[model samples]
Target chain A: MPTCVGVGSPPVMAQPNNYMKPVGSDTRFGAVTRVRGRIDGDGNLVVEGAVEGNISLRGDLQLAVGSEVTADIEAQDVDIEGTLDGDVSASGQVHLGPGSRVRGALRASAIIIDDGARFAGRLECDFDMPAELEERRR
Target chain B: MASTVIGVGITIEGEITTEEDVVVHGTLRGKLETKEHVSVEQGAVVEADVTSNTLMLAGTLTGNVASGERVDLQSSAKLVGNVRTARITIADGAQFKGNVEMDV
Candidate 1:
């Protein structure tokens, strides 16, 4: 909101610009929220609380540490730094940050497990055909 | 800004329990419980029973409401459900179709 210093018209008239700001695309769940159900979003999401349901996003999904989620997740990208007890599927990359503990099935195009990350259950990572591998076959 | 923000273009269908304040600019269709203030902003839609310390509504809601402290319905709001609160205020231009209980 530091942009409150607008072009001398006050913020009331800048409603259109306000709606087009970068904050319009990101959803954040603060440290006190506990949700149970299905979340459908077309943009990125940041979770710092607890959720017991399903999350499906067309963009990135980040679960901060101290957050615990017990549901299934589907997204374009995923970054986890918390505890998750459900399945996860991402069309893009998936990263498990430090201190993340997961116990469920995970599938993504690429997966990265950082140090201090703990994961249990199934993992399915699909890698595209590389030129070197294809050349060796020829 | 409120602690938990449900940005516009997002839709949630489930129960939400929070210990801090919540501001909704999107759509929520389920139960919502909070220990702190809960605000439904303009153009937002909520179809859930709400329990909170304070309630501020500026959108459309179709469910019962229970506030521990007070509840305020803004002028642009459209509410249709029962409301139970110790103190309540309804602004002009707001539409409400529900019973209010003060218990006093």
Candidate 2:
């Protein structure tokens, strides 16, 4: 028999190169090729191409260099190393590396950005401390 | 298998939420939420609210962080915001400014 976990049990993190799949379909937004839709998966998403929709995943989302995305992205964590033209939201953390460029807003619990990285947008943070609250009383 | 890797020289602007771990070596703007770990490697730049079980920053982050386990700011890390988590670690060369609430 399989063990039962909590409803909101955290998912297991996969390798860094097994998230997103290539855009199998086509779109009219542009001829440059883009993905338009909600993405929910358990693997890594390596977007070497372009996406014109929102990406919602249960794992990590990585935008390779030279790649562009014109939609919102939601996942457990986010690692941007390419070009994004939208908003990003994560329950875990967000990372921005050098030479990376972004134009939009971001919301998450933790955020990390390297030097030489260009970004323009708003930021929102939400940190939960249930154990901390209990410790304060002691 | 739902983990995405944003290679170097890449840039993204939007919202990213997942249930697994994520690593960034580029630039990103927007929101990032996860149930696992989020690693912002060196040379990475991110501006958003990152939530996850654990967060490790070796790059630059400007925003808030809600970590269930802990938040580690490496020597090459820089962050500015209100961080709330069970534990927090700031390296000697790490730069951070904001309200920090630990489990203590």
Candidate 3:
């Protein structure tokens, strides 16, 4: 007969599978849907609809093609391929794809503007100039 | 799949207006107006007034509902709101506590 360990067994403690995993939630808003408020959460968000408020997320934010947004956004990272009319502040990278029309200030560690994207905003990024460029400025 | 899907971990606290179908699996606390069907799936919670063409509820709702076509409450639904629609059906095991107004 096999002996059964009681509740106070030494090796009975096990960590959950998601113990060290980041928040892996995802939210998607499809086309033809419109929202008029604020959204703040800890998950990735994909928007293919219209939003008229502020958005703050701890994960990536994607604004798909044909979507329209009129709100400020703050996220870990951002990818925009639609129309945005608000400021964007990201802790990570921010990319404005082709055909995207953005009209606001952008502050991110790294920013990329693709060809054919229309943007009218202030860019705030930190860069280290090379030695040759530093000599030219003297 | 519905045109609009609110995932299980998301929450919205405002107004939503859609021209296509909507499915909710999270929490919403505001107003919802749509031109198509709306489904509040299981584990979802909606505390808002909903106006839609039709509604299929299997979650919890605590507000008023106005549907143009019909409203169907599944067995797992728990609703506490007044309903005004052309047709309505409440299945067994469903809990509802509100007035139902239908056209004669």
Top of the candidates by DockQ: 1
Candidates 1 and 2, the one with greater DockQ: 1
lDDT of 2: 0.70
lDDT of 2 by residue, A86-125 (tens): 9989877777767679999888776677676788998776
Instruction: Please provide, for model 1 over B1-104, each residue's C-alpha lDDT reduced to its tens digit, 9 standing for 90 to 100.
Output: 45888878789999898888888888999999988999999999999999999999999999999999999999999999999999999999999999998888
Tens digit per residue, CA lDDT, model 3, A20-118: 333333577879889999887666778999999999887778899999999999987788889999999998767888879999999887777777788
Displacement of residue A56 (Cα, Å) in model 1 is 0.5
Per-candidate TM-score, chain A: 0.76, 0.66, 0.78
Candidate 1 lDDT score relative to the true structure: 0.84
Off by over 4 Å in 3: A1-25, A126-138
Error of 1 at A94 (Å): 0.6
Instruction: Mark the regions of model 2 whose C-alpha exceeds 4 Å error after superposition.
Output: A1-138
Candidate 1 local lDDT, A32-115, one digit each (tens): 788889999776788999989899987778899899999899987788889999999988767787789999988987677777
Per-model lDDT: 0.84, 0.70, 0.84
